[model samples]
Structure formats: structure tokens, C-alpha cells
Target: MTNLTCFKAYDIRGKLGTELNEEIAYKIGRAYGQIYCPQKVVIGCDIRLTSEDLKQATIRGLNDAGVNVLDLGMTGTEEVYFGAFHLDVQGGIEVTASHNPMDYNGMKLVRENARPIGADSGLKDIQALAESGHFQEMSQKGTTEQYNILPEFVDHLMTYIDPAKLRPLKLVMNAGNGAAGHVIDALEDKFKQLSIPIEFIKIHHEPNGHFPNGIPNPILIENRGYTSDAVLAHQADMGIAWDGDFDRCFLFDEKGQFIEGYYIVGLLAQAFLLKQKGEKIVHDPRLVWNTLDILKEYDGIAVQSQSGHSFIKDMMREHNAVYGGEMSAHHYFRDFAYCDSGMIPWLLATVVLSETKQSLSSLVEDMIKKFPCSGEINFKVKDTQKTIQKIFDHFADQKPMLDQTDGVSLDFGAWRLNVRASNTEPLLRLNIESRADQNPKPMQDYVDELTQLIQS
Candidate 1:
């Protein structure tokens, strides 16, 4: 059997005509149906040009396998996750190539309760079956039906905050020409119906598959300027921008300054801890200083897990954690079936700002000062293993505390570094942070030292 390059460790993704196509999507659906043999499954697609056709092809295969399908047309990835557990369906799939270039398309799969199907879990098996073009014919075909999950989804989101308590604040909301526009419109309608004192100043509000304003990713410095400029131009209280599928969102403070996601983790952890003081919080090992300190002050337990959505979700389930966050802007909630949401985070942030009566910058400025970080820096190495080992051996003499959680995390007295290969991308990521060293010397020295060892 030929290997499909699109099948990554976590999900399926690749260029449109080359690495993936309608045929691959159909076979994947059939393979999944045969393996799970579920009575019903949920399906959704993003605003990508190819997603709807792929969604239909996948449904055809699932129907061929005698599995019923509930199609929620043109939605965010979180909506598919919501449909999986929120409805009486056995599994869910979303056809979306989040943040990828124009010519790419992919899918995210989940089993019941919105549990992910990563490589170690069941993705390999599905790949094997899909690669081998063999299938069993069924006597009867399953049926397909259209379902609208927006109302239920909005109802679920409102549970996070009381609208009446929200103060009047103008928000610069940028959908980035992705699937987020519909959700924004829905929320706006609800706000007007409920008379919640919130105003949304929308930019790039329409869903355009061509992405005329460039790809819908806010993480890139070049792409972030639009949101920052909009916030400043509109004089809005804050700004929010999302990627293509709207599963992950980046935040901007009132001053149009981008907030590092590491501190946002701490901020969100506080939001959850305020409601339930002793509940658990699961965080990635890459950046933990801020999360740990905040949790300690709030009497909340912080559990460290390897970075990645699958690892974080599993850890949250095992610990019964109220929330789990990665420094890369992915925030998972226990209420949302242990799945991440781009929309929920900003809503909760608004609530926090209203309650504390502070600017968004004021809330996280102190955390930024206390634990200065290098943010995440990526390096492409010819040999990732050898590079990591070189850094580890060079630091052996220092005898820093080491944790092999996601990658290798070495803790010196004044600073700490976590180096690991990315699960999705082809690069090694390094994260460094120091305690109360507002200056760059401590962080810079270790970064330079590590870079030398890694690239030497």
C-alpha cells in the first residue's frame, strides 16, 4: 500500500490535488465507518472552497457503510466538536484546512464525547484501511439529513458568562475572511435580542474562501497588523482575530498591543479558578511559570502534560481539570467535552475585564514582567535528534533539573528552557523564560548558548 503523506500524527492535511482529494476523503469515511460501526455521525465543513464537496463525498462513503450522517453545513471546527458530544451522535468530522495556504484541505476526526482520534489512538488504523482500497458492501445504505446546530451552540456558549453583567465595551472583531463570520453575526443578534451592552466593530467580516486579504491566520506578525490597526483605528476596548477554521484565536489588548499567549493561559486559568477555587488546571510543559504561580495563589492545582491537543485533552479527562491551555492560543474547557474553542476564550476575557474594571493590558502586564519569556522560536535542523542531544549534553555539567515531558525541559536556578520537535510542523521549537528578570540578559544568554549547541 502506498503511504498518504497527508496522514500526519494528529490529523489529515495536505495540498488539494496532490496530497489529498475527494477520493481520499471518501475512503477515509468508509474506513472510519467500518472500524467504529456507529449508528450515526456528525459532519461539518468550513468556508474553504473544497470543503463542501469533500464533506459530501465523505458522507456518501459513510452512507455506503450503512452509517447515518447529520450534516451541519459550513461551520467552525468547534461546532463539529459540539455536534459530536452535544448531540446523540457516535462520532464527528470537520472538513477544514485551518490556517493553511489556498490550495490545501484537511479534516479533523473525533469519536463520541468529542474525544480526538490521533495517531496513537486510532488514526494509524484508519490510514491503513484507507490506503488499501478495500471495503465491504452493505445490504442497506444509511440516510443523510441536514441539521442546524447554531442555536444550541449559542445557548451552550452563553453558559460561560451572564450577558446582563457585561459592561458596555466596543470590541474590534476580525474574522479574517474565515468561518467565524457566521458565529459573530449569531452572537450579535443574540446580544441585541438580550440587550447586552456589547458592540462589535467587524472587519474582514465576510466569509471568502479565496482569502483576498491573505490567509486567515493571526499568529503571523504580518497577518496581525490588520487586527492591531483596526483596534487602534476604531478606538475599541480590545481586538480578537481567528484562524481559518476559527478553532484558535489570538488576542489584542486595549492599546492595540498583542498579548502573548503564555500570559493568556494564566489569565484564563484565573477565570476558571475564580469560580471554583480548588479545581485542577492542565497546562503544557513548555511554559508553566505564569500558570503555576497563578494557580498556587488561587489554591488550584496545576498538572503538567506534554504539549499537543490530544495529550492535553487526555490529561484534562484524567485529572478532571476545569480548564487546559497551551501557549499557542489553544484553550480547552471541561464543559465543552474537553475540546478547545476560539470563541469561548474572548467571551470569558470580556467577563473578567468587566468584573475587574481594568484594561486588558493592565490584567496581564504584571505577569509579563514577572516571568519574561522568549516566546516560541522555531529552527529547521537537518538532524533534530542530534541537535537536541547536543544541547542536552552541553548542559549536563550545569546539572539543571530536567523533565522529559514533551521535549527536554532543563531548569537552571534563574531560568528554564524547553526544546522539542513540533508534532505537526517540521521544526524544533525552543521556549525560554526567567523569573523576574525584566531585562533580556538572562533569557538571551541561555537562548544564544542553546542555539550554538543546537546548530553547531
Candidate 2:
């Protein structure tokens, strides 16, 4: 059996040539076809150069397995997700590395209704089937067709907000030369037709597999300057930058300051709550005070879920949450088949700005002051569990309330700390926050103290 290193905890991602290539992708497609035996599936690829070749190979395998395929051409990860749930197809696959290194490539898979196929879901079985090189011969071959899901997708996105409510605003959009450009163009045209006074100052707007301006991951501080600089230069209302597959979007304020995703959770929760009270809002456990605080004021129910898309989507379904958000910038919507979208958040944000008549920074400024967070800090350690336990032992004397929902969360009266091992990496991710009223000290002090404990 050929072990496949490309299959990760949630999706398929690997270095090019060795771990992933046309042959391996074809086997994966065949494996999925054999296991699920679906009659039809929708597929798409990102801006990566190798993505198209691998996508075609996968299509060939699926066709050989007697599964009809609908190709959406080049698209973001969420587009395939949209196709899976919105269309009549039984499954969807997006060939994308999604902000990984330049030499890497991957795929994200979903079942009917856009339910993710993760490690605990069906990824392991798919991996095993692919590794075994087993095949179930079909009597006949299936056909392939080209489909355009864009118009329907843009129409659905417009449902999230009233175009009339959108006021005159100049916005900066940096696609980072990834797959987001096409969607942005579609939305731009829609805005023009609707006569919405939103102006888009686009940079790195073209789709380029070469990634002229790096990998399009704005989460890293270094990658943020392009969007920030443009926002400042244009004095735009807001700045938006997306990753390679455009599944997650990061936002910047009018001041060109990168806003933490934690605060945006509160902002979006407020936006939803303003529309309807007593609705459920799901959020990850990493940062909670801001979201909980907003939910409390808006009379909305708050549900905490472990981090990651699979867990968030499950919790959203269970509670029928109107919306869900993670500090990592992945936002989910109940109407969108509980799948995360990089497009919807900015739209909702624009709505919030219009209704509140507040600048992006002003909207989140109070929340930031009330509950200061240390953002997410990463520490590379030899033993993740050992380090987590050590931190637990240090804080045991204080007898803080601890919750192990995703990782270790210790809540003190005035402050709290959450440390969790990353699902995709060996690093221990830490987040610390304090109520400004209860503890007025600098957030850096908490960072310093944790840094000492973690390093020691």
C-alpha cells in the first residue's frame, strides 16, 4: 500500500510532485467515487498552476467510476461548497492549497448539503481506499459538463443585505492575485446594477497562479501591508484581503490597522442580533468575552464550540445558529448551508457600518477597550501536551475555572487564558484576554508572563 501523506486531519494538502500529483489526485477521485458511488459531483480548482491538471485527472477518475462531473472551472474553496449544498449534486470537491506554501497543493471535499468530510468524517476511509489501490469496475463511463455557479452564487450573497442600506463608501480590496478576483468582479458588477454607492479600489486583483504578491495570506502580519497601504492611500472605508482559495477573509480598519478576527466576531454577532433577537450565535472557545458581551446586550443566545470548521458547523446545526465565527477569520452562516464564507462577512460588515453610522474602527473600538486580547500567539515546542500541562500546573494554585472544550481554557475573575495545540501544526496556540475594568494592566504583561512560562 502506498501511504498518502497528503491526507491531513481535515483536508488533503501536500508538497507537490512527491506527496501530491496527477496520479495521486486521480486515485483519490477514484477512491471517493468507489466508496460513495454518487451519481453526480461538482468540482472546481483555484489559481494554482497545477490545480487544473490535477482537477482534470480527478475528473477522469470520477468519469471512469461512472460518476457524472460538473466542472466549475477556477473558483475559491467556498464556491464548490456553495455548489454542493445549493445545487442538486451529491458531492463537491475544490482543488486548492489555500494559503499553504507555494510548492504545496491540496483539496477540500464535501458531501451532499456541503457537509465537510474530515478525518473523523470520511477522509480516513477515502485515504485508505486510495492507498490500497483497489477499484470497483463500472459497466459504463460517466459524462462531464461545464457549469457556471457564479450568477446564482452572487444572487444568494445579495440576500444577506439590502442594497438600499449600503451607503456611499470607498473600499479597498486586495485579492492578492488569487481566485478571489473573479468573484469580486461579479459583485462589483452587481453593485453597479443595483446603484449601490460602494466603490472598490482593487489591488492585486487579477488571478495569477504565480502569486505575484506572495501567497495572499493576510493573516500573517507581513502580508497585511499591501491591503493596509492601499486602504491608507485611498482613505477607504475598509480593507479586505483573502487567502489563496478565498475561504477566509481578513479585514483592516480605515486607519489601515488590521482588526483581529475576534472583534469581528462581536461586530458580526451584533449585526445579526440587530436584525433578530434571541437568535443563536456560535463562536469558538479561543476568545469569548467580546462575543458573549455582545450577545448579552442584544438578547442573543451564545453557543461555544471547539475551534475548526467541522466542529463549528456541527454546533451551528445543533443550535440552529444564525451565524458562527472563529478568531481565525472563518465565518459561517445558517443560510449558507452552515459553511464558512470570506465574501459574506464583508457584506454584513458594510451593512453594520451603514446602520450604525460608525467607522470600522469605531464599531470595534469599544469592544477592544472593554476586553483586551493578546491575539493568538504560537509557540513551537517538542511536546505539546507536556507544555500545556505545565501551564495548567502553574495556574492550579489560583484555582481558576477550567474548561477543556477545544484546548485548556482557564478563566479567572478578571482575566482568562486559552492554550490549545494546533490541529495542522506542532505549535501550541495561546490566547489571553482580560476585562479592562477588572484588570487595567497592559495586555503585554500577560503575554510576557505566558511567554516565560511557555518557554520555560
Candidate 2 local accuracy as lDDT? 0.93
Q: In candidate 1, what are the lDDT values of residues 336-428, reduced to their tens digit? A: 999999999999999999999999999999998899888888898987778888888988998999999888999885788899997765689
Clashes of each: 0, 0
lDDT of each: 0.90, 0.93
| RMSD vs true structure, all candidates | 1.7, 1.5
- Displacement of residue 23 (Cα, Å) in model 2 is 2.3
For model 2 the TM-score comes to 0.96
Cα deviation of 194, candidate 2, in Å? 1.7
Q: What lDDT tens digits, residue by residue, belong to model 2 across residues 1-456? A: 999999987889889999999999999999888888889999999999999999999999899889999999999989999999989999999999998888999999888899988888899999999999888889998899999999999999999989988889989999999999999999999999999999999999999999988998887888999999999999999999999999899999999999999999999998889889999999999999999999999999999998988788888988999999999999999999999999999999899889888899999999999999998898999999999999999999999999999889999989999999987655899999999999978999989999999998
